[model samples]
Target: MVFLSYLFVLPVTLLVAEVALLTGATTLAGVSAVITFGLGLITVPIAAVAQGYHRAPDALSPTTAVVWHLTSQLWDVGDRIALEQRRCRLRSCMQRSDQPFALPRRAVFVFTADPADAHVRGNVTRSRARYLYRLDISDTYGQVFQRGIAVAIAGNVHATVSARRTLTATDVPTP
Candidate 1:
């Protein structure tokens, strides 16, 4: 969105402004009309691009990105906790040799997105798409803890994270 906006808006805005200024429109109404026309010219293409972006298959929705980012943070914290646990275990072992500690193995997280229900129709913003996501974070010992997550994206700007009770599985569907 950032790249597209800059590419389309900046050059077009500059060109339109220059054209408006250079073209003889000295009268008040004429200047206002020119300004309006330039604004329309700038707005139309941007709106079209934005609409296209939202509908594009390659585009990543804000909600999905937020969910992924939150899950990644959880994974990082889990790794740190697992490392500390490993260190504690090593200390208990009482290895007297002057050797560097081996790093604990990292567990891979499997993220899946469930399909949205077609029959359940709701509000445009407050839709049925909002639901609890089951996130499984595995420790170094291969024990998986389920964390229930509820993600709400308002206006595609604000994301609310509500961590509820744990579940047995994990996944999120693309918007």
Candidate 2:
């Protein structure tokens, strides 16, 4: 985070210094400002790549990619934003009806024996599972993944979830 910030701030500050040197606005030496601005501008790309940030994919616009990247990294589950999650038995679960395609969604919730489970989904590489994550979902890529657990899937959401592989609609745990 700090590295990316420095890449931008340093250049702009050098630009100001360059302007000051050219206009004789400050008593600073001219050679130093030119060298600083030249070095900062040249290093921007190297510094950005070194920090592991690059251009967005061809499909997405630059602004959209930036907004999504920021949203995912900034609005985390805790602190200013409170995203609730729980580990249940996954008594019953399904997907949204109006989605465009059938694939495993990014968020999955476990259903316990109760009727009114809170229905909280968590990120994939997340601790959303009770013992072991029986069900894993990745809505961003339009897919659903599951382990060796049985579930009762209802509603048209089932059709969308099984878009790729054949998912068992009745994966109940053995007693």
Error of 1 at 123 (Å): 25
What lDDT is obtained when candidate 2 is compared to the true structure? 0.30
Report the C-alpha displacement of residue 147, candidate 1, in angstroms: 23
Put down candidate 2 lDDT per residue, 1-175, tens digits, no spaces.
5456656766776777778777887755455566666666645344433432122222222221111100112221222221121221343333333321333222322222111112222221123222221111221222222221212122111111111111121222212
Assess the local accuracy of residue 17 in candidate 1 as a C-alpha lDDT between 0 and 100: 55
- Tens digits of per-residue lDDT for model 1, 27-117: 6445555655665565545444432211121122334432322222333222222223232222122111121132222222222243233
- Separately for all candidates shown, the number of backbone clashes (residues 3 or more apart, or on different chains) is 4, 16
- Against the reference, the lDDT scores of all candidates come to 0.31, 0.30
Estimated TM-score for each candidate: 0.21, 0.22
Where does candidate 2 have its weakest 10-residue lDDT segment? 64-73
